[model samples]
Target: MATEIATLGGGCFWCTEAVFQQLNGVLEVESGYTGGQVANPSYEQICEGTTGHAEVARLTFDPAVVSYREILEVFFTIHDPTTLNRQGNDVGTQYRSVIYYHSPEQQETAKHVISEMANVWDAPIVTELSPAETFYKAENYHQNYFRQNPLQGYCAFVVAPKVSKFRKTFSDKLKQF
Candidate 1:
């Protein structure tokens, strides 16, 4: 089956990865750092916000089963796009709302989605639409963190709430866990 990849950053990679993992057509959700100047930034480097990288999740999905538009729909619904370089309590460029489009088509889609969201809300869309860059996978401990540490304090208090919201809001697109 033909597949496409979409990389996005809306806040903590844990939250983005967790939300995308539940989608029916998504094959994998890898937490990573992208849109940065560093060759291979570690999580710590990114956290400092000097690398210019955003904590992102690369999603591999079956396009036939879930359109790019649908993916963006879920993305926009999951996080605030109005705040520049921030999401909820997470502040700094690393937590910025961004879409690292893998192709020209993806870039166009990202722009379209942002415009649509702008119409939906009076606030301008601060979500960055840019070409995809080298993605450095986060440290091993960060991958599938929600699945691996469901009861961890941050997982329970932060990630779990976002996952619940995504699952409930996009029930039709969720995969059976």
Candidate 2:
């Protein structure tokens, strides 16, 4: 299968990870930390917001099944991109809206999607666009957290809603499983 990568941070990685995992063509999704100055920032360090790191989702997908633009479309819809360094009650640099693109083509597509989706919100979109950086995988507990702890407080209240939104809005993009 032809695979491409898309790394994005829209609030907590748990939320974004859960959202993208349900999508078709998304072969894998890993929660990670990137777009930061720290070499290996811990979840606590990232939560501190001093490391300049964002909690991001590193996704492996097949472009032939779902284009990067379509991925951005889902990203833009589920999260509030206009608010800087925050999503819902989750506040900090690590919770910021960001797209860590792996290539120039992905960068261009990210910009185009953000521009096209600007009017969808009353405020201007503030999603960050940066070259993909060293991705330090989150601790094992953080991986597939939603699927692992679906009933956990945060997963049940926050992540589940986002996942539901994705499933409802993009039912056509979901895998048959």
Candidate 3:
């Protein structure tokens, strides 16, 4: 089946990865670093906020099952796009809200969605919409982090709440167990 890619950074990759993994049409969600100058940047380097990379979740999904617009809609719902270089307690460039569109069509769709979301947010949306850059997959431990370590401190507090909100907000779009 043909698939499309959506790379997004709403906050920590752990949070975004957990949220998107529940979507029915989303085939896969890989946590990674992108929009940075460093090649194959490590998690430590990103955490330092010097690499210019955002902690992004690169999703592969069937567009036939879920439109790009729907993906963006869910994205806007799961995180605070109005904050600049921050999400909740995580404050840094790596945690900023961003969307890396892979195609011209995706770019236009993202633009429209961001505009639509602007009205929904009390503050102007600060989500960065950019052409996709080279994506370096994060370390193995970072992938499916919430699933693997549900009771872990960050996952329990930060990631779980976001996942719960996404499940509640988009219950109809969740994948069947």
Q: Which stretches of candidate 3 lie over 4 Å from their true place?
A: none
- lDDT (tens digit, per residue) of candidate 2 on 40-141: 889989888999889999999999999999999999988999999999999888899999999999999988888888878899888999999999999999
Residue 131, candidate 3: Cα error in Å is 0.5
Runs in model 2 lying further than 4 Å from the true structure: none
Please report, in order, the local distance difference test score of every candidate based on alpha carbons: 0.92, 0.93, 0.95
Higher-ranked by lDDT: 2 or 3:
3
lDDT for predicted candidate 2 compared with the true structure: 0.93
CA lDDT for candidate 3? 0.95
Residue-wise C-alpha lDDT for candidate 3, range 1-177, written one tens digit per residue: 999999999999999999999999999999999999999999999999999999999999999999999999999999999999999999999999999999999999999999998899999999999999999999999999999999999999898988999999999999999
Query: Each model's TM-score, in the order given?
Result: 0.96, 0.98, 0.99
> Over the stretch 79-131, how does candidate 1's per-residue lDDT look in tens digits?
88998899888999999999999899998888888888988866888998888
Clashes of each: 0, 0, 0
Q: Top lDDT: which candidate number? A: 3
Q: Candidate 3 — which pairs collide? A: none
